[model samples]
Target: MKEATEGRLRLTILGGFLGSGKTTWLRHHLHERAFGRVHVIVNEAAAAPVDDALLSAADRLTLLAGACVCCTGQSDFLRVLLGLCDDRSGLADPSMRVENIVLETSGLADPAAILAMIQAHPVLVRQIVVVETIVIVDALNARTQMEQEVLCRQQIEAADRLILTKTDLAAPKDLARLGATLRAIAPGATLSAARFGSPLGLKDPWSDDEPFALPEISEHDSSPINACQLDLGDTPDWTAFTVWLSALLYARGDQIVRVKGVVVTPAGRLLLQTVRRSVQSPEILPESATPVEGDNTIAVIGRGFSQDQLAASFNHFSA
Candidate 1:
């Protein structure tokens, strides 16, 4: 790991599209102590954040939920960064000071915007040195995402290193094509593959594959993706909720990019997640893993729908 210059703290921006496995990769890296004496800042576009629970391995963890740090949450993000710098400066022992700060940006964030913000800020520019921007790509969905969402393309273009995730779930040919497509989007970025946060060698080299055709997506072409929180109340009917979620995705999967939350069930606190139309197997969190203030509420991310409509749909289904 390269040390920061002039006693500045290094910052690594971890960015990706919705459900691209950013948290999984960060969690593994933290467990491995990849960033020595690191402080992690996780920004979630949704008010109900579930990723923080999986990132307890960080030396210090701060959650900036309910907004995208690149935009809506810029003030809070800056405040947090400034606070970290202040705390470090106060430390008497130079060895005890934090070495690195890893910012896991919300999936919806444009890393370039965040970088520009940091670079433009006089204080942050002096105190923090952005080491790299590592963007995680969803191997199974990048082609489709790049075609539909302008933000996805921007994320790729801003990456210093692109980590293609969900490599195991994608077909070999598809993975190769996606890798090539990513390279084409950002020729300067180094590419690698990972599965469930573990590094994996690419089966087919991107150089040997053809890049997928990407359409020009205008910023106004699609409805803006937004996060809508649905309160499941204190006790949620797990089976019924699952059925309703399945039906909703079946009907509006294209409009609903991601669904995630932690709900208390008979078995345990189950962490539920869905990427597009595909539902991942629910993982039971450890007993010590506690949900934030907004537990039993799921954040549905995408566009073309309202929170009122989602709530009504769930209520009718459960009733």
Candidate 2:
């Protein structure tokens, strides 16, 4: 895995409004045949359990929150990242072996702040290469929010690729209205529709003739502080689990920018992780904290997520 840092990381930063289907879209992205080994940094504003469904994928997930990457992104980003760069840390995936990274920003994150931070981070600048920026817009609110919400506009205005999600929930004409507004904001970006199975060119932001520019330096992607860890006891009725998870999310959804953790259950241990919205599939890890190279431990990074609220949902244990 250390060898991966030496070449093209092809890192893509994912941005979107809350509940715009970013995580669901990413879950679908995991099965891609062309995708090499992937690493994710989940950032949210509050503490919430990771989507247990992802536990089936091989373990390679990290959580960062209670402090956001947008604000503390420089320190948290490098610390978690260095773990992957060092094969001794045991967080990097052993298979496929290419260290392709994806950073999922909070719903309220400004792409400009995120990019400038990454571009300037001393370790990251020397270690990784950013390939593109992808922003997802909620079809239901794009128009209204773009006109009224400062943060919403910033997210759209800074994207390299603008993806409209939840189109199916709106009328054809309404969807067009949303698209028109997004075009006005991110005129230089490739605008596409995203659904399960197909990425719909979200990764391919523009043509060779088009250019991907960086967001301004004045903006910051920081959010409030928060974190979460969910304990499912000794076992779980995994099929019926999404209910409490949904409740926990709604409790602090507005405050959450990222969430990540692993759940140990009788059904064989499974890992869990989530960015404020999008999540990566969890991989299996050894049950004990022997620090073996193959062990799985989940972590998240987000903005303004209260530690007290997160504590109610989950607990911290020895690694």
Candidate 3:
């Protein structure tokens, strides 16, 4: 582990299920320029990373690829975090002090597990203080996911602020029901709604004047959820792809917790993201964004699906 820096560092975790818009919220935060010298740690399980493309230009961003931070990357998480801060040795430059650290956990991460790791680590306990655990919930799918996925419930139960993303697509009654359900699960958490990341109160953790309260670590069992990716040799026709996806979601969306990927579509480079049955409109990536070959891939993280079933679903669209 890297040596710890002398000054206090505020850390916040941006946690949510896949396709719940964690990255979108982070982009909005960066645009606000609310924090000074904020450093971001993006934990991704994909073979090809995407958030790095979205957040690379920020003050400082590091990608910890190939594992979920709450699980395989816990030690790596500490290492990268400690590395970002200058060691207390006077030899380190003064300008190297990091004011804040934001960690965006993978969609399937367990926030309690993350909290447990931090609370137990010796270096982290002394150097880093948690400001908030902001959990983004997809309004359209919250009820089903909360009821079906233990990890989703754990994340929500562990949040200091629970943000409901993509509320515009939900009907008033449905949104109301979702709110009631969330309150039932996490009555103490602060709730806010967002459409395209609006009203996102992401700020420097220390800005809050109240005494910081850490969320309780959930005691849910840590079970493995399978994440499978399929490489689409080329972008499939948008019309056909949507039709296929709609059908798939209609049939098995309950089993598929999250779907996300990049595609070089005829329209342009696009990012497709979804949680359960709520699929956001494809985001048009800037031409400067890292280019993906015709080898673009889509990842599905869920339960009850064999790898072959997942591959066949994507391959069916390919034909």
Best by lDDT: 1
- Candidate 1 has an lDDT of 0.90
lDDT comparison, 1 vs 3, better candidate = 1
TM-score of 3: 0.81
- TM-score of candidate 1 to 2 decimals: 0.96
- Tens digits of lDDT, candidate 3, 1-319: 1334356677888999777889888887887875566888999876567777788546888888768989887778878867754442333565766678888999878887887888798877777777788999987766556655677888888898888886766766666666666766787788886766678442231222332123443345334666777666654676766777788888888677777777777777788877778787788987745555422677777767877986687667757
Note the Cα lDDT for every prediction shown: 0.90, 0.57, 0.73
Score every model by TM-score.
0.96, 0.60, 0.81
How many clashing residue pairs appear in each of the predictions shown? 0, 38, 0
lDDT score at residue 293, model 2, on the 0-100 scale: 23
Best by TM-score: 1
Which portions of model 1 miss their true places by more than 4 Å?
1-4, 288-292
Cα misplacement distance, residue 141 of candidate 2 (Å): 2.1
lDDT digits (tens) for residues 116-201 of candidate 1: 99989999989998899999998888888999999999999999999988777888778778878877899888888887788988
